[model samples]
Target: MSEDLQETGAGDRPGPVTATATPTVTDTTAATGRAYGGADPVPAASTAHVAGAGRALRGAATGGGRARRAMGRGRGRHRRTGRVTATDDRPATFRDVFGVAEYRALFGAAVLSWVGDYFAKVAVAFLVFSNTGSVLLSAIGFAISYLPWVAGGPVLAALAERYPYRRVMIICDVARMVMVGLMALPATPLPVLLLLLLGASLLTPPFQAARSAMVAQLLTGDRYVVGLSFQNMAGQSAQVAGYALGGVVAAIDPHAALVINAATYAASTLLLWRGVRPRPLPVVHTERRSLLRETFDGLGFVFGHRVMRPTAMVVFSVVGIIIVPEGLAAAWAPSFGGGSQVTGLLMAAPPIGAVLGAVVTRMTGPERRLRLLRPLLLAAPLLLVPVLAAPPFAVAFALVLLAAAAVNTVLVPLNGLFVQMLPNAYRARAFGIMQGGIQLTHAVAVLVAGALAERLPVPLVIGAWAVCGLLLMAVSVTTWPSRQVIAEEVARAAELNRAPEPEAPAPMPARPPVPAQPAMPARQPVPAQQVLPVPAQHAASQPVTT
Candidate 1:
C-alpha cells in the first residue's frame, strides 16, 4: 500500500520544494468536504467511488512506472535554451550585508573579539621575548595561530558543514571565549597559554565558513560582493586597530591584555547568538563519509571547475605576492629609521587601498570593468617597485598606499567574478578552499621573504619580490579566461539568480448539468463530497525556477 504523507502547516507550504514526478495527494479536508459549505450530506458509496477515481486519475497522469524518470523533454528543452528571466528585484545595497541588524551585531562583536585576539598575541610575544630573551621564541608565539590552518584546516572546517551555520558560529565563539578565559587566569604556564591559543585557532576555519555562508544567504545578488568587501575592510581595519591597541595595552600589563582578548570572545558569542538568524543544516546523504575525502572534494570543486580553478589559483598567487611585502614591512621600515608605527602603516596601507579600490570598483561596476582585469593584473605588481626606491618615510608610505589601491582594484573585482562563477551550493566550501589556498601561499611567501630579509637589505629583498610578483601577474593574465568564457560565466550566474515564470492555473472543466428529474415525491439524497481532478497539462507545465 502507498503511504500517506504528513501535512505541514500553511507558512511552511509557501516556499516551493524540489518536485518529483509522482506525488501523493493528501487533502483529507477536501475529501470529507469539511472545508466546503458542508451542510449537504453525501452517500458513503458516492464518496468512496470519488476517492478511488481520483487516485486512479492521479496515477495515470504521473505516468505509472515512469515516475522515477527525469523531468520531461519540455523542461529539458527549456533548460537547454537557458532563457531565465530575472524576477526578484531586491535592490542592491552595501548595507544589506553590512547594515543588517544581525550582521551589525556580529560586526561589533568581531571588532571587540579581533582586537582582543591581537592584544593577546602582542602580550604573548612580549612575554615570550622577555622570558627567554630570544626573538625566535617571540616569533614562535606570534606564529602559533598560523599553524592550525596549515595543519588542521580541513578537519576543523568540516564541522561547519555538518552543523547549523549559526550554531557553529556561536559555539566556536563560545569555545574561544572559554579557552582565552582559562589562559588569562593568573600564573598560567607559557606552554599552557600556547596550547589554549592553538585550540582557539583551530576553531577559526569553521567559524569563518559559517559566517561566510550566512553572508551569502542574507545578501542576494550583487550585494554579496559589497558584503564581502565590507568584511575585507573590517578584517583589515580590525588587525590594524587591534595590533596598535594591543601594543599599548600589553605595555601596561600582559595579563590584562590577555583578559581583554578573552572578553572579546565572550562578547562575540553573545552578539552572534542574538544578531544572526538561525539557518538549517546543509543536507548530507551519508554520515559515514570521510572528512579527508570531503575536504578533497571541496578542493576539487575549486580547482577542477573551469572558471573556479583559474580564479582560485590567481587569488592564491596574488595574496602570496602581496604578503611578501607585508611580511617584510617590519624589517623594511627600520631601514628608513622608522619604528613599529611605520610598520603598522605599511601593513595597513594595502587594506586601506583595498577599501578605496572596492568602492571605486563598485562604482565602475563588475560587468563593465571585468575586461580591464588583464591590464590591472599586469599593472599591480609593476606599481609596487616604486616603494623600493628607498624614498623618505612619507613618500614611501604614499607609494605603498598607491600600490595597494592598484592591487585591490584588481582584487575586489576578481573576487566578485569568482563568486559569480561558483555554484550556490558550493559557495562556502569553495570559499574555504580559496581561503586555505591563500593562507598556505601566504605562509610560504612569508617564510621565503623572512629568509631573504635575514640575508639581504630589506629594500633589495622587497624590490626582488616585486619583480617576482610582476612575473606572477603576467602568469595570471596569460591564464585569464577569454571574453567568451567570461560572458558565458556571467550568463550562467544570471541564470542561477533568475526566477522561473509561474504556471497559469488549469482551465476549469465544464460541469455536466444535473438533469431535472421528474417531480420526485421521494427526496433524493445530495452527494456529500466531490473530488476535483487536477489537470495533467498544468501539472506538467510547473517550472523549476532556481
Candidate 2:
C-alpha cells in the first residue's frame, strides 16, 4: 500500500495530488506476470483473476480506514511502527525541513557535535605533542579517531538497531562528555589520555548511525535529500569554525580547548534527550543474530541487491578518485614551490565547490536533478583531464573546483535515491556500510596516490588516476539500472512502509480421511476476497500463473 502527496511549489499554495496502492512481488511471475523462461501469453481470464487478487491485497494491507487515518495525522506520529510517509512532490525548501520540531533539534545537535569533534581533534594533537614532545605521537592521536570507523564501524552501528535510536544517541553523547572531560584533566598522563580518547572515539559510529537513520523519519521525500545537503554544508562550516577557535583556545591553554569540547558534547546530550522522541527498533526479525552476523548481513544487502549495488558502486568509484586532490594538496602545493597560504587555498577549494554545488542542486526540482546525475558523473573525471599537463597553480585550482562541483552534484541525487531504495529496518546498518566504505576508499586512494607521486610528477599521477576514474564511470553508466527499475524499487519501499502486521494463521478445517493415492501437486492459496482484477492490456503484456 502507498500514498503520494504532491505539493505544487515551496510555499502554501495547494496542489492537486493523487494516491495509489502497489504491491511487491513474492515470486518471479508475481512481478512481471510472465513464466520464469516461457513467452506464452497469459489468458484473459487469468489476467482478470490477477487483477482481482491485487485489489484484495491492497484492501488487506490498508485495513479499511485505519491506514488512511494514520496518514491524515501528517507526521505519521501515531504509528509506532516503521511505516514511511508518502513521497511528496516538489523540492523542499530550508523552511520546509527546518520547520519540523524534531528536525530542528537533530540539526542543532549535529552542529554542536561536529564542532566539538573538530575541536577535540585539534586540541588532542596539541596536548599529545606538548606532553610527549613527539610529533609522531601527536599525529597518532589525531589519526586514532578515524581508525575506529575503519575497523569497527559496521559492528558498532549494528548495535544501534538493537536499541531505541534516542537511547543510543544520548548514551553515546554522555559517554563522550565524561571521557573528554577526563582527558582535559591537568595531571592526566599522555598514554592514559590517548587511551581515554580512543575509548570515546569508539562510541562515535553508533551515535552517527542513529542520527542518520533518524533523519529519514524526521523528513520525507525530497526534504530528506535537502536535509542531507544541509548537513554537508553544516559540517564544512563547523570544521572551519572549530579549527579557527581551537587554535586560539589551545594557544591560551590546550586544556581550555578540551574543556570546550566536553561542554559541546554535554549540550548535545541534553538537546537529544529533550528534543527527539523515542522510537522503537526498526528491524522486525524475531530470530536472534550476532553483531558480526548482522554486520555482514548489511554488507550483503548493500552489494547483493540490484538497485543498491549500482548506486553504491557509483558512489564508491567517484569518491575513490576525486578525493585524491584534497588528500594530496599538502604535498602538491610545496612541489609547485608554493607557500602555506597556497596550500590552504588548495585545501579549501573542494569543500567550497561542494557547498556551492549542493546549494545549486537543492534549488533544482527532483526530476531535473536526477536527469543531471549521469552527466555530472561523466563530467567529473573529464574536467580533471586538463591536469595531465601540470597546469599553473591557479589553473589547477579552477579545474579541481569544477570537478569537485560535478562530484557533489552527483552525490545529492544518488544519496536521495539510495535512501529511497532502502528499507526502514536497514537504514542504520546500510549507512554504516556506505560510510565505512567511503572512509576506507578515501584512505587507500590517498596512500596510493601519494606513493605514486614519489616516482612521478604529482600532476601526472593525479591525471592518470582520473583517466582510470573515467573508465570506471563509463562501466558504471553502462551497468546502471534503468529508470523503471529504480521506480519499481521506490514503489516497493513505499509498499513496505504501509504493510500491515502479519495476521495469525487460520486453523485448518476438519475433513474426512481419504485413501492415499499418487502424490498430487499442491495448489497455491488465493485470497479471493482481497484480490483485484488485472487490466486486459497489462495482463497480456505481463502474465501471472500459479
Clashing pairs in 1: 42-528
Please give, for residues 309-338, the per-residue lDDT of candidate 2 as tens digits.
Answer: 988888988888789888888878976789
Best by the lDDT measure: 2
lDDT of 2 at 349: 81
Give residue 518's lDDT in candidate 2 (0 to 100). Answer: 89
Q: What residue runs in model 1 are displaced by over 4 Å at the alpha carbon?
A: 1-93, 96-99, 339-344, 368-372, 387-392, 487-546
Error of 1 at 436 (Å): 1.7
Top candidate by TM-score: 2
Q: Candidate 2: TM-score? A: 0.77
TM-score of each: 0.71, 0.77
Which run of 10 residues does model 1 get worst, by summed lDDT? 4-13
Output the TM-score of candidate 1.
0.71
List residue ranges in candidate 2 displaced over 4 A.
1-20, 23-89, 499-546
